[model samples]
Target: MVQPLDSRQRNRYSRQLMIDSIADSDQRSLLSSRVLVAGAGGLGSSVIQYLAAAGVGTVGIVDDGRVKRSNLQRQVVHTVDDIGEPKVESAARFIDALNPDVTVETHATRITPDTVASLLRRYDVVVDGLDNFATRFLVNDAARLAAVPFVHGAVYELEGQLTVFRPGGPCYRCLLPAAPDEETVPSDEPMGIFPSVPGTIGTLQATEVLKCLLDLGEPLDDELLRYDAADATVVRTPLEPNPDCPLCGSDEIDDMDDIDYDDRYRIED
Candidate 1:
């Protein structure tokens, strides 16, 4: 646990604290809050950088990928010289250089069902910067089990979607009852997303995480915000809690270990 910073630290964040919605205590909450960001790629890059700059106390980054030349296009934290370096390591270095006040933990491994629960239990909030449906579902279910809130974002082509999953609000499974067919869901390699797509979505994820931590404004709780960068239009839609939602529904979930992804998502051969 991190103790609150002294007057010097508080002075540094004074401008932000001035916002009526976020006072000194809220700033302290941000400083003491811990966030776990999955995937240190495009989206994670922005999420991690912004949160660290905002003085988030502890940030945990999980990524098995290496910084590639291709990633430099969107992953602002990594430069051409960083190519071939482990993403989590690279991200941690960037955060440290940006703000010594933030303590960063790097997990240079892929997130799997066996590891998700334990990883989620360590953080106050989780940011879904993952690119695949499989991992997204894993994070969502794990966060629900840990009873922690998560902000999710997805980017494909020029479009992006973002939402917040509060304990009582609708979980991601409610909106995406089933993962898209593997054959239909394009991989980041082939899909070739625009750099700005995840940049925008990831920033929104960071914003929501800060708001949630500080108990600030109206969170997306039961709503999804979609952005069309080409048209510069954002559309908001309400998400209703599914009575049958296996993860956060009315039905009792006997055990976290018992929840199966295959039953929830229709994966095609």
Candidate 2:
């Protein structure tokens, strides 16, 4: 039930439509696609920008936080005037201004095990832009249970990582297996992040989303793409689904109740 591109769409996506892999049909797929962005911070900002500009028909933004004066350094979608506004609302405005064709659904709320599954079912793909490991693991587990694709991205200082997990593929749990010891996890100190790090990873996450929707290029299926911004080097490492992975392995997860994420991550004040 794909719609034909109108005059406005043709003009708006002229450059993209010219790509041999992304013609009218692919563009139509993008128009029919629905993507959920997990956060509205640095990575979410970039993911939303490109996804909207590329004419994604529906985008759902989920974040319970509000903008702060400190977030302006890397969260590109929010402005100084939006510092006091909700991140979801600020991000929605940015998307609307970027492309009116895009429909943005904002969930100005926190993501939890109970709500994560419901949130993910509403979208075709999930973009991981969350800053914390707790929410990230929640998303990872939820997407796997829903049998949906999750584009994973993370940034720490000058380093970033990108990966994709879909049904029957290696998942986030396969990589981490278990959360780091809460006691040993570093507190959110003033660890300087090169602004471009998240930008780089977020853009790659967007690229993965587009490719997933269009089925064009090879996805990072079982491989993690790591980027070191300081050295300007990219490395690809192959990953295999852990046979013992409780989430996506021989001991497949049946529901969210059995898992305990409470002690896994501690929120810093």
**Top candidate by lDDT:** 2
> Clashing residue pairs in candidate 1, if any?
none
Q: TM-score of predicted model 1?
A: 0.92
lDDT of candidate 1 over 1-269, digit per residue (tens): 64665888877787787787776677778878899999998899999989998989999999999998988888888988789999998999899889988999888887887788878877999999998887888888888878899899988789999999978788988988778765676544446688888889999999999988888788888889999988999999989999878777755665466765563233222
Q: Give the TM-score of candidate 2.
A: 0.94
lDDT of 2 by residue, 63-157 (tens): 99999999999999999999889999999999999999999999998898778888888689999999877788889988887788999999989
> What's the C-alpha lDDT at position 119 in model 2?
88
lDDT of 2: 0.88
- Given candidate 1, what's the lDDT at residue 190? 49
